[model samples]
Target chain A: MNVPLIARLAKKDVRVTVREPYFFFYLAFPLLMTLVITVALGSLGGSVPSLGVCQDDAAAAYLSSSGAVDVATYPSIEAVREAVASGDRDGGLMAGEYYVLLYAGDTTSSERAALYAAVSSALAAASGSTETVDISVERLEPRGLSLQVRLIPFLVIIAAVVGGLIISSSLIEEREHHTLDALFVSPATPFDVIAAKALFGLFLGMVLGLLILGLNGALTSALVVVFLFFGVLFTIGIGLMAGVVMNSMTDLIARMKLFNIVLQFPALVILFPQIPSWLGMLFPTHYFIAPIISLTQEGAALGDVWWKLVVLVLCDAAVLVMAAKVLRRRMSGMLHLPSL
Target chain B: MTVDNPYKVRNTYVTGYSGSAHVMMIEATGLTYRYGDFVAVDDISFSVAEGEILGFLGPNGAGKSTTVKMLTGQLVPARGVATVLGTDVSRHPKAVHERIGVCFEEKNLYPRMTVRENLQFFADLFDRSVDVDELIRKVDLEKWASERAEALSKGMQQRVMVARALVNDPDVLFLDEPTSGLDPVSAEQIREIIRAEKTRGKTVFLTTHNMAEADALSDRVAFINEGRIVALDTPENLKLRLGRRLLRVRTRAGDDFAEEVLPLDDDATPDRMGALLRAGGIATVHTLEATLEEVFIQLTGRKL
Candidate 1:
């Protein structure tokens, strides 16, 4: 294994990929999905609501001290209204002739309720009324992640797995262009090419995966990184297999989309309560993100998902082994990959 | 270009075949290959000496490429030995690869990379220090060095492929259809480069169906058909033995010209042609030898 040769090949591939029109588009896939999820779940904010107040020092001081709601003091009542309308604050409270509670046009019903509660409580507590309604909130179904947090795994997969998709497409393009023949006849070995593609895919996927996770505010402990690695490995196998098996770019894309649809069943099962949980286990990637989802979102201990971690490894190994067999068989006639 | 023998065949006058004092660069002994039941390359033998161009001429699917594949160690011969550069090809393919350069018929270059970058990438692969600018200039790609390969015309791209083959300055070069599809000027330019490489003392194995190219470029030509070598010798010999056997003469027979076809190699040719000259007026005489294609057809009963 010539390390420099592999690095050179991988570096060329990265540069080539950057030149491809799809590079920016592929990189934007994670960002696009993140934006969609954020906008859809932004109104469902369970984090402390922020409110702007002006000419109402008592309410602002009370809200700030309450620790349940966040308060931002504005210079004037008009400033509070503008802040609320621009979505800088969730809602606003202002004192003109009388106290007024404001709501933005785009505020969801949930935000409206929170704004009403914040205003009422701040005004009541500010007036020295110690006795007030103590509301206790409980969920009918406990131990479930918010819809926004629940979709982070999906976004991470999208962000990281683009690398594998790029690898597979790059392989097919190489074949069509006959660059493989050029490389094989040179001092470079088939293994050098294969190793280069795999290495590039791993690095690309890892970077995008970490970036997406960070953007989503998902926890990135050692365990999450390990699971992300497994996820990327599984994707690389699928990507290489698809690239090797398909002869044309159109066919590769068609098949990859179908594969992606099937891979998303686990995400669907995790998101929708109506779907059966056991169904997601039928797919190999289910094991890949199951433990990570629990660790990052649910704060579950390792022992709780230890078996899942083992299953993830086994699944990754199985897919990677199958990919190797397929790759070797396909390249045998034209070239041969080195023993990894 | 004005040199009578522009091909610069170093050992053309050497009567002994494949044993010129010059080192043998490529030797295939009874080489044979099969694709399942189909015999792509039957038992064949040939050798090329250093600084010589051996044009393996044949039509598509005539085993020209198959033989090259074996000699290049891309395919294992079923029952023969392919010795290139004094080493068995199959046993030490890597060594052979390091020492030999090849330009495939297909212009397989990095489409997104510039001409200089493409050459640079291969130089890095060989792990040899190559002057990128010099290599680009070798292929006449200096003007297009910074232009992406895809942006260049097919002729320019093929030039880059040729340049890539010269990156390592290997002992032997396997050029498979170096100028398959190109304008006359571009093809001539490529041929000029091949001629230059020959002058630089590089052995070249050229494979193409274009007999004119074979006649113009090869020091020796091998006519391959049906996975077998029909004839292997200098083009002059092949043309003399098989071609130029027929002659057409026109003579006046009392104001009405009569035509007579004469076989130069036929025994009755002297009596038939002499009698015509004795009778007095010979109006016109036209004679030309058969082309390499016609010779190949005559030898193999098939056209290349």
Candidate 2:
């Protein structure tokens, strides 16, 4: 409500966040990893099968004896020959010499073998017709999905969201360095400090999220973007709670590890089950990934996930209220020390 | 030193309290603070007059910080009352906080903000914007105005902390070992700033274990030991009160012969010092008196 106080706090938050090398690494490294993975491993669907097909009758008959490969017959020799050279099949079998054709960029053994099997089957079906039929076929399975496309973006989003983790660490770090006590003595309230930190961390999470979305073209749903904003708020609130509850930096770190195991790891379970309705309603970031992919891949409207959005917003409010209470108690002399 | 001018410290005769009379700024009666079953400050009662610098001297864990925390309304008193600036501290801490400035013993500057921003942040807290340039010059931090707090040396940061304490220009300033962990020169700078605040007629409640600091700045020193006020008086009065008879004086002569021992409280006995000086053989005429530290030891039977 007090603009100047909030502004000063905001300035302080920015300075503290930027000054730490770890915060920067936490903020920047994930996006970089996502970019590297996307560039290095994206679009790698098909690689290889080592099998080969021959245009000769004997080879074609041997392959046709097995029903493993599909072969198509061409009407004319010229048509068959063109199909073979054009990589419609891995190899073409004529009277004797088998010509194995490779796509310009095609490599890896499995791809070549699949192609040969198809062509050999087609030639065997032709069965030495003086009509000079030529055909080739290869059954090569393209990779299910590129590792970068499928997992990198998901990992990046999860990693980037953990900027809130660093916010909690910074709060504890300030306490260890003795700054939090000075803040307590100032006229500022614990609410003011907590709000400042949460807002500061929220801004960082947003920036990192935006960068990944922009680079990968993965974030598409405007509704999902709104979901993400609230998700960030919840994460920041959780971080503040962690910071306020812990007595020291070491305790905070240990507690954070426990939180990661208990709270964050469960999101892994949530991901595999088609995102159960109960989970979608409960976990604030439940729609965080689904909406992103839906928007990017399906061009789906974020309005479809509006309920998830509402749930996340509520989660943010609840967690933030809890965090504010803990912070106030910590700032005050609520923690009992044994009388010495 | 004896002054020809009559404006120096004098014993004022007063009979009753009146409107024009100076009132106590901080008054604690039977103040006791405990954590669970342990009492940190035990029934300590004392009062500080308006525009007074009350030295709260105690060694580590002597309940000095705990007492200060109660007085400043940071910690609720376990038993008894702490009235700061006429408001019950525990009952209305917000009011107390609004009126007082606190510079704690901890090195608690926001390491991310610049020197100027740290001061400005405090200034904004008081509902008034400060001239950043003027504040910088006052703290002698003009050279590092834009440098982040983390970049400055520890002494420099302490100076910045002092500046922050004065930003609100509060009525009462609570300094807990303000100059601790600082070099002598920087410690002197902090002292100078504190003295300047006192000159502005602000009440200063300072806590420290440093005897020289207490002796140099305190209007009245309260020696706290084991959560009790062992002795409370002006530095000179404490010294005079304890060193009753023995007045040891050193003169620039042979080691044994230069020492003059005289009775202090019994002026009626003889003017031995005047006679020695009138004899014209003494190089320097002086009186030996107990320091605040010596007096504290005498009263509390413990070293500060």
Candidate 3:
């Protein structure tokens, strides 16, 4: 572990990966997936939260045009209250003597967030003030959550998956292009090259995972951030191991399809809680996403799920060790491994 | 097409005290390597003297690359020792690597990186300051320095590979088919760089199947086939020892030309030539020497 040499080699790998057109193509999956999902969640949500506006044409027109929710015109503030009270609409806003808002307790936080944005923007426009619009709220019940939040864990984990894939591509291209031979023949030992590859995978995976977290408004928590870090390591370890099994771009792409099925299997299993938790835990990605679901959805603290983090670290160590061994052997004239 | 008289073999040595005696930079004794049950390098013994080029010539799979790999410490010989720069390659591959360079037969440059970036990356690996522009200039590729390696023509890429090998300014260079597939001008450019390396007192171990390349660049040519060194000597000596120089005689035969060949090395050639001239109707006379390929065939009894 020559730090300077490792740093230099890692820097070179990063440069080569960024320069490859496929890196952007490779990264676009999670980015575009996140972008589309987030945008869709913001506008359409799980379903549009309808709001009733009474005697406030400005707020009604503004909310309707905002597209965050459907705004129905009510004849009076009494009608708006009845609509929100019955849960036919998510919330209500009216301008009679004062600006008032009525809320439904059954709406999830994301749905309420969309309603809040639409109501605030509509109220601010109606009052002709950029300052925060003050309004009184009346809730029919209380607050809760639903299935929409589950998508957040999936988005963040997919970003880590892409990060790992970048590592696999860099490793495969080096062997396929025979640049690995060039590296070894030059003063680089197998440890130097493989370590550099692992470092690059970690760096890329962290960046992507952080981006997904930022998009989901999940970066503020230290626990989620730590879990995300180890989660990335877990996936990156898999990515490095994937490189050991691949030599050509076509082969990597082909196997990547299978890897996708394996990586997503655990996430998809979450849809059916009736399936045994141990069965889902059998996959290493479970160590990653389960902690995420616990921390984000269930509000579990570090003490509650610290064991999963340790499991993640162990899994990363095992995968990295296996990846390093096979990759080193592959570079050492193991023609059966990667003769390309 | 031979420009170098005996091809810079005997003079590169240091017997007359112009400098320190040129030591053998590469030596292999009874080196053997096997791929499972098949032998790839078999009991090969050869040495490359300092500042000299030894062309290891063979056909497609004649153990040339395997022998070089053993010498460079990439592959450990199954049977004997490969000493590079007075250190055993298997024992001190890193020690040997810090002072040697190798250009593989495959085009292994990073495709997405610019030529300068590719060269600079390799140069960084050696921990030595390399003037990449000078190397790029040496291969006549100053224009393509900013161009990605994959964007260059095949010859230019080969030149980049050559320049990359020179980045370390190694004392001994092992080039495996640098100009394997190139236009004549590009191939000649690589040959010129090789000549310049010898002039600068750098030992080169060139391996190729092209007999002309072997003849033009090698100080001593070693013919390898079926994992063995069949013949090893200066090209002229090898040709002279196993074969003969001949004269091609042509005479006017109606609308066609009748040709007869005479061995120049044989006795009574002058009488035979004089009698042929006296008989008249001579059209053309040309002298031909046995090529290195012909010498290889004479020794191994197999065409390369």
Candidate 4:
């Protein structure tokens, strides 16, 4: 590794990336979207529960019912009630004497009736009283959505795009000005150039990716970071490959758009929850997004998601090697490589 | 010191070498290239020597740039052979490229980089970090050294290009219209730099349709038409061979000018000019020198 060359290449990468408005947008916009989406989804899904309270036997029985929402138990009724009132519940239950008060946030009339009816039925079954005791249910709106959980995948995608913008623009700009030719003619080896571009792109992608994660920590997970590293490599590889393949800026943009539409989009949607397993397996992005969602949404562990990580790594490696070969061919000015 | 030497500077040959010299730094034999069905450079042969500036003149689609690209290793020859510094340009372009500098017609510098950074970056390309200040000074851009390349004027940018091309102190320099976009002063400065390079004993392959530039700097010129060398010789020799009798005389009749036809061979034109000067108010009497443009038009029946 030529340290100075690496440093110079990195500096050049940094200079070009900082100068580009779209590069910042590519990185931050996705992260912002991830934050927006995660917060929106989390807020919509409601807050996590911090405690629970049962004011009476009926409320306790209702909470314990199969249909009751499971909530983590904590100390103090007022505190739990306050937690519920404040939308802090991940969910919980509450009961009261005589009235059988069910302290949950806002719910539909039908849902309230169902809980009341559940409590009424449980009481009747316990005491052999056909007459039902009157009960009331109340709801309190929570202040904010839990956005951290929802935006993780979006942030990662944003990171990948940031990587794409930084790597692609810099590379293409270099080629357009024929600076790449000058650099290639120098003592800087092909590998040196490739490594410099890949590393620079990876750093930029991760920074933008993590910037989104920073705004909302829920987007970040160990597994996501691990897979995101590979995602970054994949983005940079494709970008450098694009740089090598296309001789002009117009061709680069056109090719980037085409690739994103035909290849990148299909792969992203293939991992949706309702999609069939075989179809999802066909897309590399499916594996990347699935593991991230599993980690942030379902709170899954790395051990459980290692296979997905492996698949992403393999895909990243394949693209990188192909990109290197394409780059070599391009420097030699052989037949033009496909844009995407 | 004696006020002047007896021998006049005009028409005096400054012989640095006593005999025929081997000044060919770049040699091409029957080079042929095609882009799809169109042949860009077809069976062209030429050689450039050290301290020699060979003006590559051609029409718009005449393959001058293509041939320069091949020599610069930007493109490989489809057929025939080329050697730069004993390295086959097609096979060992990297080696040939190391010893040469190329300034394409397009402005290819990184616009975002500061002038100093630009020179520094190119300097590092050769693994030699030059004094940026010195280069900036050389280009007469010391004041704009900290400014971005995009901010500089076209003339300033051209100077920077010349500075960058000299960063490695190359053996051969390929300049494509170095002064095309420059003003008179900047163009003259570039000519001075080219002369300085010659003093340093470097070969220059210059490509341009600017006839004045070709005449001013080129030691010999190769006129390429339709991808073939139609004529190649010294500027004076070509002019002497192809010139017609057209002389313009300026006489003081309120900036009036007169054109007279006369044989170019040595004759009594001086005596006739003396009679005209004695008979009329003559402000200026000068030769109607045929420009390279006229020569080009005469030979190719087309303008560059």
Tens digits of lDDT, candidate 1, A169-223: 8999899898988888888877789889989989999989887776665544788
Instruction: Quote model 3's TM-score.
Output: 0.79
For model 4, the stretches where C-alpha displacement exceeds 4 angstroms are A1-6, A34-150, A175-195, A210-224, A241-279, A295-303, A321-340, B1-19, B245-260, B264-289
B109-224: candidate 1 lDDT, tens digit per residue: 99999999999999999989999899887778799999999999999999899999999988899999988989998898889988999999999999999999999999899878
DockQ scores for all predicted structures: 0.35, 0.30, 0.36, 0.19
**Candidate 4, DockQ to 2 decimals?**
0.19
**Candidates 3 and 4, the one with greater lDDT:** 3
Task: Give me the candidate number with maximum DockQ.
Answer: 3
Write down the RMSD of candidate 1 (Cα, Å): 9.1
Which should have the higher TM-score, number 1 or number 3? Answer: 1
> Of the candidates numbered 1 and 3, which has the greater DockQ value?
3
lDDT of each residue in B99-185, candidate 4, tens digit only: 888776767778888898888877876777578788778778889998998898999889888888888888999898889878999
- At residue B186, candidate 3 shows an lDDT of 99
List runs of model 2 lying over 4 Å from the truth: A1-3, A41-149, A156-160, A246-287, A291-318, A321-325, A328-340, B1-20, B249-262, B265-286
Find the candidate with the highest lDDT and give its number: 1
Looking at model 3, residue B106 earns an lDDT score of 89
lDDT of 2 by residue, A203-224 (tens): 7777777766656544444654
Q: What's the i-RMS for candidate 2 in angstroms?
A: 3.4
Q: What is the lDDT of residue B70 in candidate 4?
A: 80
After TM-score superposition, the amount by which residue B276's alpha carbon in candidate 4 deviates from its true location, in angstroms, is 10
Global Cα RMSD, each model: 9.1, 11.8, 7.6, 11.3
Per-model i-RMS: 2.4, 3.4, 3.1, 4.0
**Cα error of candidate 3 at position B170, Å:** 1.0
